[model samples]
Target: MTVMTDRPHMTTEEFEDLARIAAQQAEGLRLEFIGGVLRSKAMPDGDHGRVILWLTRICMQHHPDFWLHPGQGIKAEQYREGRAIPDGVLAHEDAFVGQGDWVDPGPILMAVEVTSWDSDTERRDRIERPRAYAQTGIPVYLLIDRLKCQVLVHSDPDGNGYETVRTVPFGKEVKLPDPVGITLHTEPLKDWVR
Candidate 1:
């Protein structure tokens, strides 16, 4: 059995390095630095993965210029001194370079998060993350809440959080504004099991 130890009060850079090393050691695990803390989570489950797949397909079919990356870590230098790993990220083809593992939030067009089983996870996805993304000036933030069966589209960042917030139920379609400019069919999301 592997032993796990907690390193308290680590700086952002230290946390990021630890996360990178941990990810390399455990291939399937995803580790992120959030608010100076190292947060680790398992790879997404079936339903979560399905939503990401559908989002990728939709983006490819409608907005070919944008690149949809699933399970990628985005670094927000201006926000909370941490890196966030969103469920899905939509950005321009040339937004990221080949050098680093983390993508800067500046080039990211939209960041997507799917709510998980834990309440802490849900709170982070719904509240904390949106604030972080907005502070980083990422244009849009999309949240898929499986527990609530709804999708929230957040835009108009104001450093602290979004100024505009729109919500749509699972069956309804959510029209992504301007740069993205496409309607997302959220029907398939309704079929999410737990």
Candidate 2:
């Protein structure tokens, strides 16, 4: 039932080159390479932006030194062969400083995705994201599932994937694990997901 297949369509270098050209041809078009497959990311809707804004505020309030950077390109999966543009990448303020377009995921504490209103949201956000982030050993992968009205916190990456996953419905409180020790009062999320 895994979303990612074993075979990749192209090498990381080819994918990166294609991504660059694609971005130039179509403004705001994002491409991701994961599980050896190519996937396109849709543009965010207002609600999606709002959700990220809310999380950014909370992250800054609790950890001023940390940041929830939106649409940050990250090197992912084994041998840094995969690349993904996570909706939000949580890391220290200068984690990506002076880095190229796709930065290393080592300093990233968490990767967040707010479900989009699209056919690919389910596989892209719920399945591909966690697996990619976990395989890169990211400490956490937080998914704010708009359609499901729930938040899934994935942590404890055991290489292949995360070992622990905790889901909390909207309006309930959920604590993100260490490296990102922030307790979120998710009631406001109810407002944003609409």
Candidate 3:
């Protein structure tokens, strides 16, 4: 069921179709088309899920205008026709009209990814995903690297990548910039996988 290839060369519609079919069959697995390639990963472990829950809770309590979505697909037109399924996403409350699965990157306020157990997954989360998000002009990209026990916030996308990057350790609070102005409490994020 792995869809990782050198050049998938799938159209946006084709990618979406594949993702829809995959979602119907697999419950915890996420299939995404990123950077002209199809990629798949299983659901996150306990710590990763906890981190996302905490962030979602905080956003719900503090930010009334924003909506927090866990495990959703985001379509970024700039990245050679691929959809990205980030670990968590924060967007305007009215970003989507109805009960649909896919969302465009234009209305996205932030995209978040928690580092996975696999090294290849970690590499894609740390490197390729951010570039793809930036190319789509996503305002902010957050990486929760449990392996490094640090959180990295990237903003001000310059087409190719983000220009401003701020990294902080687990116990520190990293401030998200305007529009999504809030501080993320990273102290409770335990590296469950070692």
For 1-194, candidate 2 gives per-residue lDDT tens digits of: 66545667888899999999999999989999888999899899998999999999999998899999889899998788889999999999999999988999999999999998899988888887888888899999999999999999999998888999999999999999998999999998888765
Task: Estimate TM-scores for all models.
Answer: 0.89, 0.95, 0.88
CA shift of 77, model 1, Å:
5.5
Ranking by TM-score: 2, 1, 3
Clash count list over all predictions: 0, 1, 0
**Candidate 1 lDDT by residue in tens digits, 1-194:** 75334443577778777777787898887877665556676567888888888888888888787888877788863644768889888987777867377767777888988887864776588777888888888888989888899999999989878999999999998988766777988888989847
Say which prediction, candidate 1 or candidate 2, comes out ahead on lDDT: 2
Better of 2 and 3 by lDDT: 2
Rank candidates by lDDT, best first. Answer: 2, 3, 1
The segments of candidate 1 whose C-alpha lies over 4 angstroms from its true place after superposition are 1-8, 77-80
- Overall local distance difference test of candidate 2: 0.91
User: What's the lDDT for all of these models?
Assistant: 0.79, 0.91, 0.81
Residue 158 lDDT in model 2? 89
Ten residues in a row with the worst lDDT in model 1? 2-11
Between the candidate structures 1 and 3, which one is better when assessed by lDDT?
3
